[model samples]
Target: MMRVGAVAAMLRAGAAVSLSEPELLGLAEHVRPGAVCFDIGAAYGMYTYPLARLAGPAGQVHSFEPLPVPYRILEAGWRAIGARNVRVTNAALSSSTGYQRLRLPYRFGLPIHGWAHLEEGLKHPGSSAAARIVEVPVYTVDRVCELRELPRVDFIKMDVEGYEAEVLKGAEWTIEQHRPALLLEIEDRHLGKYGRDSAEVAGSLLARGYRMHVWHRGRWNRADRVSTRWRNYLFVSWAAERRR
Candidate 1:
């Protein structure tokens, strides 16, 4: 579970490490030397670890992940980096503060593996690779903020497969409270997975006073990630505007 070198390589390769942080190309312009960052759906701490480095000793980074395997991987990976400012939480975010079964998108080229297109929506519940269910505690961004007992967050990076909309919904209070900038990944196929569409996710961001923009599209040459070839939508607001 602890794939230290593997995951660390990912961070070094330019993973966001936090949604609030910009992608590699725009990182220097968007990120500050000491800013708090929240990484949602942190698979292996790829984004969280580097974020700690960016935040330096004064900044803080937090990762929220519900998938058990990935969560453990993240724990060990972050430990390897020795970023004391980083914190990892094994919790999923949804529209409300409760439970939800997160279906893993099929692994590429696994013969019997479900089609990777299930990001479009799971045609069957039993197609999961684990072949067994994994229950992960779920939370709202608001709940996370409350539990952390913090006021005013600097940034929030969110990529919860197809649940981006739901995650944003649960973070309503956090959005209104901190007004953190957002870098959200949106896949039409993944949106369909949760019986929704990317437009809905985009609409949610639009309503939150964010100046919306598409950073880039995730076009993989191979069937790499479950979210293969989805567009990544990034949102940022000027400090003065964010305060509004």
Candidate 2:
């Protein structure tokens, strides 16, 4: 069932700053009416809020943010924006369903890397900010869909720090079921933090018959494999094995 509670959210530019990730342009451009979108790790509803607008009344957006503060902000944003089709949930998407110890950031902290930046701040010590570690519930896309009774997802955007692999792992069933396009953040430092390689992430998707593409230097390029930049990437799930 959809978690019921008061969540925090904010409205920016009236455009929904929650959907403010850099990689979504490619996916946003192709959005259609009645489309169903999922924004995993949706911090503060930047992606989720705007997507709720894009999808319009006919389309729907399922936004998941587990971090206590972020999840609250997401909920608030939904209420502030008042999109009838938007659904916000307080949970995380992962390769498995369980609890995970996560690093908490100092006030106004900037990520030294990706979502795993809290861990980096701890290891580096030279970081200007301090962090606290906390444990929270984790779940997978498949589990979320099953719990919410959602059948199809048109687009899936994930930015789970360095845990993209784990998120994809839990999404195997959903990937096969919805076959939606994916826009994920895959940086070398982030992947390295989790000891995962791009080949595994990219190869796994390719093997599943999803077409791959990458956003490079402001242009969207359809790549046969993962991009070399490793900063951020967009993986489009095409209908066939037409990898390019």
Candidate 3:
């Protein structure tokens, strides 16, 4: 069961709370019915639920969340909503398959659970305490697709704190093969903690023929270069763009 307070807070906010960005919801509209989607770092099924709903019953949604607390909340929410096509996985996606320690931070006696990352040294914003390290199973996108026999992924929404680069590395094969449209969050400051930069992150996609666009004031603006500030980016594959 989810903490009563948390559940209430979610209910109060409704769909708007989960799909915080207008661009994300707009992107979801692009997913046709019966498309397969992946929601990385799907905390509490916010975006997951909306994506699943948009995909409809014929489609499938695979969501990944490593932390136990949020994972439980996410699973229960799916069950409560009777989302049959949504599969919630209690694992983190990374560059390799195996177990890794996730450092979760605390603030004001409450866990800043969503900010937890695979990098041990990374720090969360706001006043924090010693991190609670939890062992979590990790899977690469390729590994998961191979193991689960997933259909060609049509879209992916990835927001794994600062570990987006590592996750992209793991999904390289999937990206090359599927050329799925991507909604990625970039926080250069957080990436710096993992010895990564925005250019390196954006370069990974650009090298694979992805055009980068940033969401601003309800519209997507093409970005020739990745900025240092934290923001969300839409990476459309060249092939997909051509089709559009």
Candidate 4:
């Protein structure tokens, strides 16, 4: 989940603004011109715009955001920039394609659109409560890739709350074939909502020869173990690792 303040700041910064944070700047190092990138759980087009800029006019950027409010904002931001390389999808990506209840959690009487998720039957921390439940269509990355006829996928940045594992499950074909670099947000608490853990998520990728790297001190540091504190991690294939 994203922070409300951060999301707001990014939206105010506009699509043309350049990224300054080290972690965001680091993504530019991995993405090359003509790269095909996916920004899953793109709240307000924070990473989507930068990815579109990095991919350039020749490349394609697919951004997914299930929530209606943010989806509209994401769409508006994309249009505001008049970018032709980006495609905004108003759907969530999971293991199966269907409709699911998207929880819009609220705190202090304000909806925390940033923490909105698809996990049902889980208690949120603080005063976070579901302000609304909406049925949003879901799709698998493989299905979308097949439908869109994507020649190749160079990179994927996913932050679908606790459903990261489920998304990976559906994206197996894309992962195996393209071996694209994956930047994922995995938190133990969030995973608990779906009866999952970080290891279960990382295990599947590691088994497929994807090495985990933590962003630290303005660089990607390879790690055999997941960071106990940080939730964001970059996973790359053995071939990409060799290139690095």
Tell me the whole-model lDDT of each prediction, alpha carbons only. Answer: 0.62, 0.66, 0.79, 0.81
Tens-place lDDT per residue, model 2, 87-200, is 887766677787776765565665321243323212232344666666767778888788888867778888877677778888888888777788777665556666677778
lDDT of 3 at 105: 88
Give the RMSD in angstroms, all C-alphas superposed, for model 1.
Answer: 7.0
Write model 4 residue lDDT over 1-244, tens digit each, in one string. 1232244346435422534334575777788889999999998776787777778778999999999888998888777667688899999999898888888877778777867888543554335544777899999999999999999999999988878888998999999999999999988878877788899898889999999988777678887776666778889998887886
User: How far out, in Å, is residue 18 in model 1?
Assistant: 18
Tens-digit per-residue lDDT, 163-203, candidate 3 = 99889989988998999889898878778778778889988
TM-score of each: 0.74, 0.77, 0.87, 0.88
Provide the clash count, candidate 2.
15
- Model 1 stretches astray by more than 4 angstroms: 1-22, 105-130, 216-230, 238-244
Q: Where does candidate 2 stray beyond 4 Å?
A: 1-22, 107-130, 216-219, 228-230, 240-244
What TM-score would you give candidate 1 relative to the actual structure?
0.74
Better of 3 and 4 by lDDT: 4
TM-score of 2: 0.77
| Tens digits of per-residue lDDT for model 1, 12-45 | 5544544332363343344466777889888766
Q: How far is each candidate from the true structure, as Cα RMSD in Å?
A: 7.0, 6.0, 4.6, 5.2
Number of backbone collisions per candidate = 6, 15, 0, 0
| Residue 171 lDDT (model 1) | 83
Residue 178 lDDT, candidate 3, scale 0-100: 91
Highest TM-score: which candidate?
4
For model 3, the run of ten residues with the poorest summed lDDT: 1-10
